[model samples]
Target: MFNLFVDSLIILLVVVDPVAVAPLFAALTHGESAATKRRIAIRGTSIAAGILVVFALAGGTLLDALGIGMPAFQIAGGALLFLLAVDMVFARHSGLRSTTEREQREAETKKDISVFPLAIPLIAGPGALTSVLLMVGEQGDDPFVIGTVLAVILLVLLVTLVSLLASARIMAFMGETGANVVSRVLGVVLAALAVQFVLNGWQEGFMLIEENASQMLTV
Candidate 1:
């Protein structure tokens, strides 16, 4: 149980990448007032959680029905995740610029910015989705472990929202320079986690192949 929980915890943390997202959140919510920021933070976390939890519960089963193997999924997911990582490193303007512009125009009219750029792509983006499927695949039949890990993910989301609530104080102390430093560090961590995902998939795939070869030889 302990081991399962620990593995789940790692999966949750790596997938969620709360630390990496913090600076981005800070920047996005920069001009919003305290109450608005709080609401946005809470709602954003909720939305992200809902997306991941739904996928976690059904992703593996869906994959099996499709006759897809984990090795194939891993390679595909790794490529998607790596593309996202590249984007994170480069910090490009979202391709939905026209839509974002329209939203921004709407925001100026009504001061609403919670759901548009904040919640969707930034929070519950490709990185999170890949993480969900990969972790679900890794969990296999360990429902106890999966549940525990999910609990930890919820806790982490709560803590991250709390940190976001304290964004004012953190920004006041750290300023943009400090925040950028923190963001870069978190990116490094995310990169390492991404590498680990690839490694684990490769390791398991090779081990399965080895076992199959041994069995055939013995037969």
Candidate 2:
């Protein structure tokens, strides 16, 4: 359980990449009043939290309804996460996880962006949503593990909110190079975790096939 909590926390934090998104947040909220910026940060984070929580709680059921098995979800989720990790390690913007240049330009022109780029794509993006589903599904209906994963999700969201609130200060302190260095380190860890997910999924899939074959032979 402790391991699950730690692993979930690490995966959530890395995928969320609060520090990397700080610059974007800062840019988006540039020249806004302190009160307005506060509203944006709070609103964005709250909406993002709601979205992630929904997916974490109901995502597995939704997938099951679609006849998607855990092994397949794990394999695909692992691959997607690995791609995002590669983007993080290279300090590049991945359309899978990050907003594109077009989005950024459009955001700059918008008066309100709490829900568009900030809450959806930037915070609760594909990688983050897929991660929550994978982690929750990996728990396999264990209440303790599920609770721990959910807690980690909330914790990461809290941290992300704080990072957004302190974007300017954090950017000033870490700078671009320092931020990239931290992201790369987390990216490496994420890549390893992604590979483990894929391996577990593959092994389980093969075992399932073998078991089916044996059952057929016995019958």
Candidate 3:
């Protein structure tokens, strides 16, 4: 359980990628007052947390309603994350985890970006959303484990909020070169985790089929 919590924390951190996000946050909030930037950071992280919590709580139920299995979601989510990992390793922005070209252009023209690209796509993008749901579903119906998962979610979001709050200083200190180096390292980690997810999904899927077959034979 402790190991699970730690793994969950690491995976969430990699997917959230606060270091990668700082420069973008700094750029978007450029020219704003310190107070306003702080507000945006607060609101963006808050909204992102809310969105993730909803998905974590209801994602499995929603998938079941749609006749989707955990294995299928795991494979699809892992594939999407792997694509994001490639972009991260190369220091590129894939729309899977970041903004699209159109979103970026639109963001530039918006005054309040807290709820737009910042909260929706930047902070709580597909990578982050998929990660939370996967973690929650993997834990099944254990209340303690679910609570731990929620705690880790909050922990990651708190880190992200702090990163956003310190974006200016973080970007100035790290610069693009330094940031890319960190991103590439995390990218390798993310890629490995993504592959693990896919494999877990495959194994679980096979086991599920085997169990069904045995049950049918008994009946």
Residue pairs of candidate 1 with colliding backbone atoms: none
lDDT of each: 0.65, 0.89, 0.89
Error of 3 at 117 (Å): 0.7
How well is each residue in 23-75 modelled by candidate 3, as lDDT tens digits?
99888878999999999899999999999988888888888899999999999
TM-score of 3: 0.96
Backbone collision tally, model 2: 0
lDDT of 1 by residue, 92-118 (tens): 333321136675455445454456555
The list of candidate 2 runs beyond 4 A from truth reads: 138-140
Please count the clashing residue pairs in each candidate, in the order shown. Answer: 0, 0, 0
Question: What lDDT tens digits, residue by residue, belong to model 2 across residues 1-219?
Answer: 788888889899999989987888999999998888889989998999999888988888899899998999999999999998898899888876777788889998987889989998999999999999988875657878668877998899899989999999999999999999999998999999999999989998999899999999999
10 residues in a row with least lDDT, candidate 1 = 90-99
State how far residue 29 of model 3 sits from its true place (Å).
Answer: 1.0
Between prediction 1 and prediction 2, the one with superior lDDT is: 2
TM-score of 1: 0.74
Which ranges of candidate 1 are over 4 A from the true structure?
1-32, 82-110, 207-219
